[model samples]
Target: MTTGSATLSAATRRSVLLLSFATFASMAAQRICDAMLPELSRTFSVSLAQAAQVVSVFAVVYGLAQLFYGPLGDRRSKFGIVTFATLSCCAGSLMSAFAVSLDMLVLARVMVALGAAAIIPLSMAWIGDTVAYELRQETLARVGLGTTLGIVCGQLVGGLLSDTLGWRWAFGLMTLLFGVVGSLLFIDRRRQQAERLPTTNTEPVVRPGFVAQALIIITGPWSRIVLGVAFVEGAAGFGVLAIWASHLHQALGLSLSAAGAIVALFGLGGMLYMVVARQLIRRLGEQGLTLLGGSLMGLSALVLGFTPHWLLSLPACLLAGFGFFMFHNTMQTNATQMAPKARGTGVSLFASALFMGQSVGVLLAAGLVDRIGSGAVIALGGGVLVSIGIFFARALRRREELMRLQ
Candidate 1:
């Protein structure tokens, strides 16, 4: 558990950068639909609630598809699977751009989600294979620059493209990004294969059947805790975030682009964390970081819920972004170590739980927003997040104590 900067080797840094680009593409595609809800509703002549199906459906499929990718990543080459998945994402984004009907768009998004489900978790698994556990969180935060910027750009790009060129252009842009990243990864894979040499020092991967691996991970106490927490975190955090654009547009009377810009500040907060991640980790440690992140998120939610003017949302969004990554990166680090022997499967299941939680949260929020209003829904989510943060901090402290004794 050393605290100094963990210098990445040249090859590892290159691979991480490539993977980060792919992650950026995937995340951008994921959030593009958020800013398009109003346009989609108008274009399809559907209610706002119906338009939200675009996000929810993608999340549901994304969560389910993780199960398949997990075992595949464990058994096959993670980078190879990611390369193929990136290509598939290119196809999906292209399909989305040309979708003629709501159903077609939903179907296209499903494809996008299916492909995207593999990228981040598999990348994390690959990192776990190469990086030590003590330095994994710091590595993740550094590599996460792509993810944080993608989140920022996703909201901004989605809003800007949807406002200026139309929602189709957003997907079109994603299509181009996916194509370029996928091609680069494919070439990198070939080069790696050519250079790879067999070695006896490396242990052969003993991959169990899919069902057995799933059962093994699900039955483990630590895995179960991590998965459960991730599920709830997704439900509580992303569920409310999913509706930010719509809330700002409808409730605050802001333009779609304006709403997106405000929400995009969240990513800036995450970027702030990335810049000072090592310092924060050194100063706060896991438990302290968890508490601080949760508090910030709760404060942000309350501000968003109660603020009389829309102008105040900027700082709120920033706080939410910073807090979210602080809390989430910790969970992600734990996920990488949940089952080191089957790291891919473990991380995939962790992601699966998270996205599944998002789907459930969105569904529930959709039902509740109309009744209690978006502010109330957001406030409730914030409260839950605070509770989650506290619980996890205590849990991490106990785990650390147990490890010290061991």
Candidate 2:
């Protein structure tokens, strides 16, 4: 149980690689609807908010389902659960492709959410069980390259397919993606079992039921702060993000494909952060990351919201993406270390708070879009995120001092 990647086994590395791909597909499925929101609205003859149910409902189900997965991953094989979940997503994606009505599509999306719910957090917990804290952030960033890329790819593909082939084609792509990734993971699992490798490690379980484990996580003051910040991060960051493409499409008069491409830069920026994350983590420290990441994203978001010059969007979106990952990567590191005794429960609880906030944010933002307009809403989200950064930075300081006293 070395904590450093330098001593990490080859089998563990391979497992992490496969888990990364699974995460990519899971996240891509979640965001595939971003560019398709307008097209779905037009196709179904519904309002923007109604069309957004595809994203919001998925978040709702995705968040709540984490409760089931926390204990499950802790007890069983996390990788095994992830493999099954990835395969399950194919069924849902196929259903989404063939969805005959809006309700049907929402239901189909719920199916997808049920499966996707197990991927990212459990993968992180699995990593937490393996990688030591010294290099965990960098390793997670490497794995998160897939997640961040999925953000861009999902939007890019959704917009591109919706514009060219049709919206249905987007789901078709996800079906193919899930099937391929799941099969690969299944093969890897079999190989690991056959070889009797020790790469697939699990944490030593504490004697508690899921409810008690969850209570242990939620009752900690530091855990409460991480969960709280995560909730706001979900709402203000990812939740309000559902509208960016629509805003560019509607207000800026860009095509959905074009708008999604620009928004894809946000993920691209995130990828950039992932690429350089190790360096930044060494340089800035977590507090600096939180404060600066939030400021950069907030200012960049304001530019995207207010600037009539669409060209400015190129840099604004890129910087915004970079800044977001800076903060987000820091958050991920803290989450993994939050509850060592019940790492699975702690990380899953963090994920639950995040997407639940996303659910609430999407619902609230979508409603306000009609009244205050998308720009105002987006800018408002940016401002809130700045405050979040500041609050979390101070909290980090307080936590460090408390650790010293202890």
Candidate 3:
């Protein structure tokens, strides 16, 4: 290989790695907050519903902020945007550590969520610019692993630290990590800029029609169906875990730590799907995989709903987790392919749908748990997922036929 080409490749690899780490670490903060909420609620003498606002506010702000970040990445420097976002996360984490009231804590979580939300879109966009389409899934798979592993680590670490040292220390340590990592990345970026030559008359690599691209993904050919599946799939997987610790504690007499571990196992299923999804995609195609994933999620939810046994529910959780990711990944992968011109906006729109689904899922589950029961609420989610999948299958078939005609 040529020396300059090899150097460029190495630089790109390093950048992707740094961004991936930043993304994983930022996301870890999200779930860890869940573990801390109960403690905060007790300290502030707030109801569980009131304390849950911490997560609710974070999810909403995080999803909404992506709309801004996608355009920022297109207009400004990605490295600068990432560094700035990480700084915000660091500030939020430190502030939350010292928060004296539930209101202050919820505000702090919003800061962290807003800061961390920028990482994924920027990283994925950066990767899209660097990698070819054919090999993108392998790279995406690697990034997906980072996200899922972060979920697992967040649960395990949040519970363990909250149990051993106290919840405040979790936020404190996260603040330290964010501060250190953000500083290091900023320094590295400066060093790279100093060493590299400035190019003259460079054109914008990302297209200007990012908003249109976002709309297309949000409202395109069978886009609603695809996004609907993404939402339901996200709700079934993310919604359950978001509320499950309390549900298990109330229904089956599980401790928070034990529940966290069980949730960690469920996350492992997603990690496993990330590891093997490329092969599955190659063999099944997107539609087939979505159907298979949706069906499994439906079956798992049904099992969890009807069985009432923890052991049985465990495997059901695993299947549901795996199915959730498989289906969600299909939509995201397709979205990325859909608008290569505005990849950041496209993927961000996809994330917006998924997160929106999650917010609704958690809120809906929380409300329904008292009236319909956890089992029935989850079964309802599973039913929605299955219906979305069936619809998606038909839509994909029509798209394929149109492609043949074209």
Candidate maximizing TM-score: 2
Per-residue alpha-carbon lDDT of candidate 3 for residues 263-295, written as tens digits (9 for 90 to 100): 665567778898898798789887887898889
lDDT of 3 at 8: 34
Model 2: C-alpha RMSD to truth?
A: 1.9
Worst 10-residue lDDT window, candidate 3: 1-10
Extract clashing residue pairs from model 2: 3-132
Candidate order by decreasing TM-score:
2, 1, 3
Pairs clashing within candidate 1: none
What TM-score, over all chains together, does every model reach? 0.95, 0.96, 0.86
For model 2, residues 62-157, the per-residue Cα lDDT tens digits are 999999998888878888899999999999999999998999999999999999999999999888877878878888998899998999999999
lDDT of 1 by residue, 255-338 (tens): 889988898888889999988988999899988889999999998998887788998998999999999899988998889877
Candidate 2 residue-wise lDDT at 158: 92
Instruction: Tell me model 1's lDDT, rounded to 2 decimals.
Output: 0.85
Over 4 Å off, model 1: 1-6, 197-204, 400-406
* Best of the two (1, 2) by TM-score: 2
